[model samples]
Target: QATAMSVDCLGQRAVLSGRRFLYIVNLDAPNEGHRKISRQSKWDIGAVQWNPHDSYAYYFAASSNQRVDLYKWKEGNGEVCTSLQGHTRVISDLDWAVFEPDLLVTSSVDTYIYIWDIKDTRKPTVSLSAVAGASQVKWNKKNANCLATSHDGDVRIWDKRKPSTAVEYLAAHLSKIHGLDWHPDNEYTLATSSQDNSVRFWDYRQPRKYLNILPCQVPVWKARYTPFSNGLVTVMVPQLRRENSLLLWNVFDLNTPVHTFVGHDDVVLEFQWRKQKEGSKDYQLVTWSRDQTLRMWRIDSQLQRLCANDILDGVEDLIDGISHLPEPDKTLHPQDSEPQHNSGHGDEEALKEDFLNDPLVGKKTDQLGLPQTLQQEFSLINVQIRNVNVEMDAVSRSCTVSVHCGNHRVRMLVMFPVQYPNNAAPSFQFINPTSITASMKAKLLKILKDTSLQKVKRNQSCLEPCLRQLVSWLESVVVRRTAWAFCPTLLSSL
Candidate 1:
């Protein structure tokens, strides 16, 4: 049976690792069909991964006893290009950098992780030694320099700039960690499965403890976050049964699985979420099992989209329920009752006219209201709002405001409709700090937009949460830069 398997980023091919042969399957033409690449191995192949950057390269790496083999596709055949040798023991796992086409990182039972440049395989360009042998390693999807490794019960986060020491370390599991994967949308969030019969979620920004834990009665062999949703898929080894080991969970609500996939006659070795097809509204999950068979499970669009919003709605409902409880006092102090007024109506009207004349103004609104809910939320946080220009047409409402949070400044254009906090969702866009790279800006906007939409969908004011997240990210960036400045060795090397 194959012990390791991987699907290419493009979802066009899959590679399965067996004892002495590698099976490459053409996903697009399964019947035409599979090819076997022969290799000499004393033990089962440990891991296999395809280059994530360029589909045209068709390059992949497979790890086995003390070595990694790099192969390139030539006329439908995998030709061995190079062999990376460094580990003194069996290699455990490997991953390709999301942004670097030729960069690969492999972990081994020798307590060492090697970073290789596939173009020059004479030796690894960088190496990291851990306290214990590592079982799995993964690269951050959003941050190029950040990577993580799991050894025994500890998970260590490393920044490539400072390879000598880990940036953050935490005792993640009570037993051996079997799988690790980062959240697709959040750079700081990661998930891990363990032999301790549990799955854990962590935010690297908070190193002392995990963000969430999913308890299972059976040993979890693998847990992975879905590509476009907050859902997680886990493969568990049931104590008395081999069937119904695959479960789909909503991260926010772990009390129950949203759905369970049951079909495998034996334990699932590995499972991964395939890339969504263009114009398709659903996602496909592929699983390889000890049954010597592979199966693809299709998740409908409704299930995927429900993950974030449903979780947020549950939170909103809980808050609403708590807020309805009796309070200790009914009377407000005179100081707390002081009236606040809008003082710049004239300037706002002028700005509204200017915005209305813009070519991008697809819709307009005139009935714009500054909800007291938003005002109170902002005041409690002491978030400074500057250059507030409110505008509206008959159909839509919007405002351009500059937020001052400590030393960070963010300018955004917020658009709302009359049914905001009920039926319509708000939009947020960056209007200042045009200096940020396109990729960075896009990620920022995506987080903000998702957050705001979730809030509005719950009929709650969103500006506060959106602004809070932005400020938090900015603060984290500053902290990272400060830490980097103190590493003179890293600075000199760079």
Candidate 2:
């Protein structure tokens, strides 16, 4: 299997591999180390999304499936998808809507909108959109069913009840609208970009012709809604000397530039607020450039990060402010220090049991503080295969990670271009299998065996594939940690 990309939680690592498949590589190092627990590969992953609330389960969109699939591995991974089906056009974007995780939407380049009762992607309870290119879809944070979209040069908003209700229609720009997003706090607010020389915002519920318009020197690439509720962030390509640059503005009035992010050598394709750890002091900004580079920009100040965070009415709120959630619930007005959720927080027995039972959470918590309700099932990862040492064919550019404990041989041929990073030393990485023995493959197979979190099970079944389950795990292997914790420093950058 080939992976176009992969993403993992402190608990489970997922590989978005080709052949339209996803492999869950259970890991422990939210701080310590990554190891494989179990894996199940299914569907052709066009898009894969994790439940922001929990890491064990996830959603994937595929062409053959023609539905949004949900999975939960707790009770032996099976399709939670017996009833859920979404989208008619090879489901494009599937996400637990930011405002409500229960509500799910999927779109295809084919002009159709299918809103499914997330429990089942197998069917769409509501639908909309005309015969046109439906490039993007987004819901108004305050108003769930109200959707805004970009189709060529038109920007339109539709209410669920009246799918035909074009609450706000604008033949806004001459060229295709490339980006559209809504401010979390401001209902009826919309920001969009196109080939036009300007990025514009509109207040649909109001009578204003255009809420505000900021000039763009070049055709804007894409613009995102800033965390400031009503502000907007726009990316544009600069003339010859450079390919592109980004601009941030307060769309509420659009009179002044709040921030300008420069230094990108190519067009910054997209920008997003990397939701920081719930209670941690660290804050980050991410921008993906066409130059095939992902740059991590640390928001210079703590207060600055708070200001750019996605809290409505902001961090001063007594309870609703997400960034300030770790503090006491002023709404309840506790008499002393805020009580945490753990039943016996300091009880070593309970903690030890929790960690042993569910190593995923213990490790996933390395830096990204997890939500209070999160929990997981127990798993032993990386059954270390130390006996049959790694046999690397260095001259052939063949590098692999495997567990060669005596007779068992489970391995993943790694394809990282060895020339990228500084001090890219060669070291053997094992998936942290479990209980290695002389006949390692068989014992490892039994442990690696897994099924889909969804209900549908392919007629095909075997125990061997799990040998090299094709998963990635996280481990607290960092000796001297820094801001860029996960990626190793490349000699090129060194």
> Among these predicted structures, which one has the highest lDDT?
1
lDDT of 1 by residue, 1-494 (tens): 57777888888777878886777876655444467788776877778887876553488888878988888876678878889998898898899988888789999889888999887989999899886898889999999999999999899999887888889997988898988898887788888899999888787777666776788888888888887556788888666664445777666556445455655557788787677789997787777776666566667643454344221233332232211111112111222322122121100011222232442443322222123333332333322312222332323356555544345566777776666766467777777754455775676687677656655554555654455456544443343344211122311221
Worst 10 residues of 2 by lDDT: 342-351
Please report the TM-score between candidate 2 and the true structure: 0.50
User: After superposition, which runs of candidate 1 have C-alpha atoms over 4 Å from their true positions?
Assistant: 55-57, 310-494
lDDT of 2: 0.44
Position 423, candidate 1: lDDT: 44
Q: Pick the candidate with the highest TM-score.
A: 1
Pick out the ten consecutive residues of candidate 1 with the lowest summed lDDT: 341-350
